[model samples]
Target: MASDGSPSRDTPEKQKRKKKQKQRVEDDEEGRSSDGAEVRLDDDDDDDADEEKRLEKFAEEDIQRLTAAGHAALQSGDNHAAVKHFRSAYSYASKLGTRRVSKTCALNLGAAYVEAGNAEKGLRVLQRQGSSGRVADLQFNLGTALEALADAMEFEEAVRSLLRAGESYSSSGNPTEAALALRDAGKVMLQCGRDSSEEILNVLTNSLELSMRITHSETRGRILNTLGLLFSQMSLSSEAVECFQQALPLLSGNTQTLAVVLQNLGATHNTLGEFQKALSYHKEAAQLYGSLGRRAAQGRCFSNLGFALMELAEIEEARESYTHSLLAFKDSVCEALGAIRLQMREPEKAVVHFQEALGLLSRCQDVSSSVQERLVNKLSEALQHKLILQQRKAVAQRRHSQRLPGAAMRRPDVLIGRREMMNSGGNTHDRNQVSTEFHSEEPEKEDYSNTLPEANRNLNNTHDETDTGQQVISSQPENGPGEPSVECGKQMNGTLPLVSGTVTPPPGRHKATPPQRTLKSRFCTVM
Candidate 1:
């Protein structure tokens, strides 16, 4: 008896019909296999055969015409037209009940959909065809579609699709294709940066071993580059450098690819503090990019070159390189200029450069918060420097006034007059009174020993009283040996904090100025 109030016989009859339908579907799928095997059927299969024959009679010609049109449209880059034709062809093949033709049409239709940027539809079509165990090409096409989808940011599904492709290719005895799919899957794993490190390593190891056995240099080079990037992410810089270098010769025929390897090598060397080697590689890359007429790429190379030069303390050359980079593209070079000027102790100039950098950032549509924060911090540092300079200037002026000699000491007449007034005293009490009056009338000399300490203490107190923004520039003295002493911030226990970063002018000092060039000639050279 059935759970519903229906007859049990009806349920049994329905199950029998479902069983027949299942068997027919199984037969159709088996017939679709690329390996041609004889079809087996039940005793009552004549009706099924007759039905399939009639469907084929009506749909066969239509499928052929539609498939041809689809191919033609795809070849001509009419992806929409190609998709339409392929869909019609697949529909006809499905109606005809020709399983092999239907599967082929499905593959073509999916590829067309993918070409038309309808990755979702393409994935669906390929998934439907790929459930059958022996469709290696279908799996391969699915992997291609998945990679395209991944390019469109469908990452998770792309990983699964590539893994399926790798498995399918391996089963079909194509090690190279299998390795290629696995390699791409490993790349996605790296990009995801999930906790699948062991799985990614296994995929990459398998791909690498298989790739080594193949004679495809381009593929091997690409694999090596991927490995290099992976190592870079892992902070294994030496190994990354080796991999990038090994990939270089293999990729030499491809200019764009070779330039990328060169740039990567340059960046890796820069990270390792090998500035000279980095400079050489960056210069070569810049030349290559120039030859290719890729302005943005050339600008990037110039910017990298500037970074290496700045690390080497070649500030002037770095500044020039940064200027060239700016002409090509606006970037972080203005901030770099601020840092350079700050290092040179030119606070006013640094402040100007920082303001320029901040203004540039304000105009950008996609400014990152971290970059803005860094620039703001830099500006704060510059302002603090300016304050320190002002404080030091005041202290210097006070020291200058204390050091100046009175003209009375230099004049013989004034000295003689003072001596006569003391010598020609009327009495002992009168002489003592006269000396006391002279001493009281003259200005008392300040004890200069405590001057530096008092100035530094005042400066420190002022700094401490300022807001959080001023604290970005450290006012605390460095405790380490060989650390450069900061003005107004050095240890001031008993000994005075030495006021540094200033040169005392010699007696009768005159500033030496360089000859200036005309604006027209300088502009011409810069241009």
Candidate 2:
């Protein structure tokens, strides 16, 4: 009778009560029907004549007060007042309320609360009405509120709210709102990438479609930019270029927006290995930003140009660009970061960048828990990279230190390491099996031949034995290509380091450089 050894509460009376509760829940979810509030002509109870007449008189008076005052208060931006009067509406409507008035009043009241900076209260009121199509709008409001609270507290529930909003918005003939929600969701999905590119293209595509249809040119431009950004994520530079072009013209009077677009387009091109195009875009962006007095944007463009130059193997030019960007965006966290990273491609530099970003965000009075957490993660990644680099550096230094004394007496900077030999040694490769069919004996061409230039001839004739292992003479330039006819200057295999730099001790053994501070910024700019 009782699963917990308590008296059974499963009687018919209990069942009826439970059923009523369930129905109540369903009703609360679906909102109250105006039909129940309406007076039915079929229910003409003669005993209620006196009461009905009195009720009609009171309701008529109440409706007048509710209607006049509520409208006036709403116009005056007194949302709380508006809601108070709107709540009295049910008492005033003798024949019950119309669906349009009831639903619209509730929605408008909730919206007023939101506009008045009472999101939590608004959400509460909105959620009181179960499964109305307005849930989507409520969800959007909830997401914004949660994002605002993210700095002070964790709003992990924002995702569920966002999903609900998306569903409702999609179902309510407002595809644009749904698309926007999907765009937000895609950001989360893309960050989910581990090995391959994240599968956020579907969400982005939907956003792109809806955004394109928006009537506002500025908003339309932003959506087009979103497409460009999505394409950039996939390293599809050409497609990104097309999107950017469409957006740039639309965003044309807004200097700051235009500069940012150019900068993004420039960065995308660089990533795609299009240095020439990247250069032109960056230069234009930098100039525009400079004219607009937007130092941060100007500096960012400069840094992007440096990265492009670095890819082209123009080390000196890259360094100059980075230095300029750092100076221009001196107050900017990313600028300092760009400088540090350009110096050595060090993760420590990344840490500095993140820290700077965090600091800047804080200074702007926008410190949030999410920003702090992201910065912390970036710092951790930087530290790990720094540790790995330190380990590598220590190993190289140790080897160099051991050879310091013999430097004058032996070859310079020779690499020393114990190597393992697999199976029977003579560097055997099972030549016949690893190659295409070779003539059994048509005066078999020697593997080592005159085809290789004379520069390697001397190297082939020499060999050295070391305690570590048998050292073979390397018959090629250490930093040059192995191709026999390669231009010595060209270093055919591109084996040499792109930049020329002598390893020097770090500024200080335990210098505390700025840590990277990854703050959430302009994430919705493109979206």
Best by lDDT: 1
Question: What is the TM-score of each predicted model, taking all chains together?
Answer: 0.47, 0.42
Mark the regions of model 2 whose C-alpha exceeds 4 Å error after superposition.
1-122, 133-136, 142-175, 188-199, 230-242, 314-319, 331-527
TM-score for model 1? 0.47
- Give the per-residue Cα lDDT of candidate 2 at 526: 5
Per-model clash counts, in order, read 0, 11
Q: Report the error of model 2 at residue 60, Å.
A: 14
Model 1 lDDT per residue over 297-401, tens place: 555567778877887889899987766655444434565566667667798998897788778767543233545565677688678767667656755765565
Give the runs in model 1 whose Cα sits over 4 Å from its true position.
1-77, 140-157, 171-173, 234-236, 330-527
lDDT scores for all predictions?
Answer: 0.58, 0.50
RMSD of 2: 28.2
